[model samples]
Target: MNGDWFIRGRDGRLSVYLPTDDAVLCRAERALGGSWEPPRRLGGEQRLRPGPAVGQGADRYTHLAAWRPTKPGEAGLVHSTHFRPHLAALDWTPIGHPGKTGDRTGPPAVAVDARGRAHVFVRNQAGGVSMRMQKEKGGWDPWRDLKGGDVQGELAAVTGQSGLVELYAATPAGILHWRQEKPAAVPTLEEAMDASVRPDTLYALPTSATDTTLFHTDDSGDLCAWRPGTKPTTVLPSAGPSRVSAVRCELDGHDCTLLAQRSASGRVAFAAYPTEQESAGAWWTESGPQLPADALVSLTVDEEDRVMAATLSPSTGRLLISRRKDEPGLALEAWREV
Candidate 1:
């Protein structure tokens, strides 16, 4: 029932998020200033970049991009996200759409790099094909219409880390990856691979090299952790039921990690994840046994780096900072009675 979290600013200041709208809010004192009012609704002509892929960069200023909808029926008439560097404005001007939403062939996702250089990953209506766009200071590079594969969900990044290491799902199949300069395509398809964990296995990553990917699958109920780079499966220490729903970056000076899942265990709960596997050195080396009551409906990190927050709505479902585990019989009741 406690919905509060804090963050450390670039100037060694602490900012806090108090309960407000029914949205996982993003605050950038450096960008938006100290104005903590309701999100300023842009002209209905403008919409958020659409998806969790939007992020704040490392520039002196805050950054996000916004684009106008050229065609009809697009998710956004104008798309906007944080800020970027080198790029004229974090905003974008579109060309055209492929066809419909809910289809593989649509628009590409807009993502920015550490310096705020803009890059996009998407699949157009052409069916069997994919696309990527890079934006320069003045103009943009040609769309490298890639035949690699379809990008599922949205995109994610960490400065120069996970952001550039593209992750997507290859239809009728599961997770795959596309790094900055490696082979353009990932190596798996709809092939049923053996994952020691299942259900809530995927997670909002934090640049871990060991098992960079996390997802949910019904291993011991719902489990979450990194997918083994060598094996076509997830390497999770045996843990009790747990599910990681949403995640946010809590800045401790220059270091950033994650605050996942939520717990009314009376104290804000957290688990440490090494940026890489070897970094995990025997951490979660064995799946720590927890239970399903660990599932989440939705949650976020506040200014103080505290893993505090609650449902966007008392009826939204569960917010997880870990893997999907058996619920400890706690669902969204009401803040008045948790």
Candidate 2:
């Protein structure tokens, strides 16, 4: 399970920090002038993607992708985890089932293009990856498996005005991707109009990164920021004098602000830093109070700009929601039994 992490909204009225199972858990708080309130869960189940993916606009919308374990009488469900994804529409509308039993694919993630369409990227059974688009008008385009190596831990993001959906997939061949045809066709399920495979990137991956994200460092020796593109940005140099321990970043308007925690092994300490326009550090500078030792996750921010974080110690089952206190303001609120 992941602890808390942050992201800002289009209008920045809502700030979110998600901490949940293998899915994306969006916890939002409203920020008017200053003070903020405790965070609460968003609608529907978490994401089915390897991590989490979101699309925020007018009010704030998100996508939670995940892998569910199989229960009794379940056959194909074994290898394939139950995938449940929703678009933050007036009513949460589900996409489609990501994988089948024994399916070699990992999880599937979708990005909303400039045209209000959803694009899905997934790796099929034989270790091959593919892209699919679904239009707002109602219809899933065909799935075009991208050519090349085996893919896992898939992710994607649509460029602001360009309408290009940039895709990122962890692969044995290294990080992989493809540029969407600006407002690309809604991926079709039709037999015709299929996609041709294309290859990109050829770098070896660092094994320590079970999940990969863009990051940087600062003068205080704290690491922060991520210059995430529709594709993978350059990774931090593994070899460093200080030894980068952690990183954090959240979407802020047109860019991102990353934070990090760094210290010697067995040492407990924390620092904060911002990614210069150039994302100028080994990572993002983690700010605020220091987290308890043994916490396994990083920091997260919401639309209100308030930051909250959580982590479960392997030795103990504890869930913590610690957020920065700001000028309390009015916010859209909802609650239900989880």
lDDT per residue (tens digit) for residues 1-338 in model 1:
11122333345322332222222234323332233323223223233332212333344233232323334644421223322221223343443333334222332344345555545545554533343343435444544544444333333322334334343333335444444543222222222333443322334344444224544444355334444354443333333333444353433332333334433342233444433332442222111123234233334443343443332222322221222222331122213211
lDDT of each: 0.35, 0.37
Winner by lDDT: 2
Predicted candidate 2 versus true structure: per-residue lDDT over 149-200, tens digit per residue? 5554434333333454555444444344455443564332211111121222
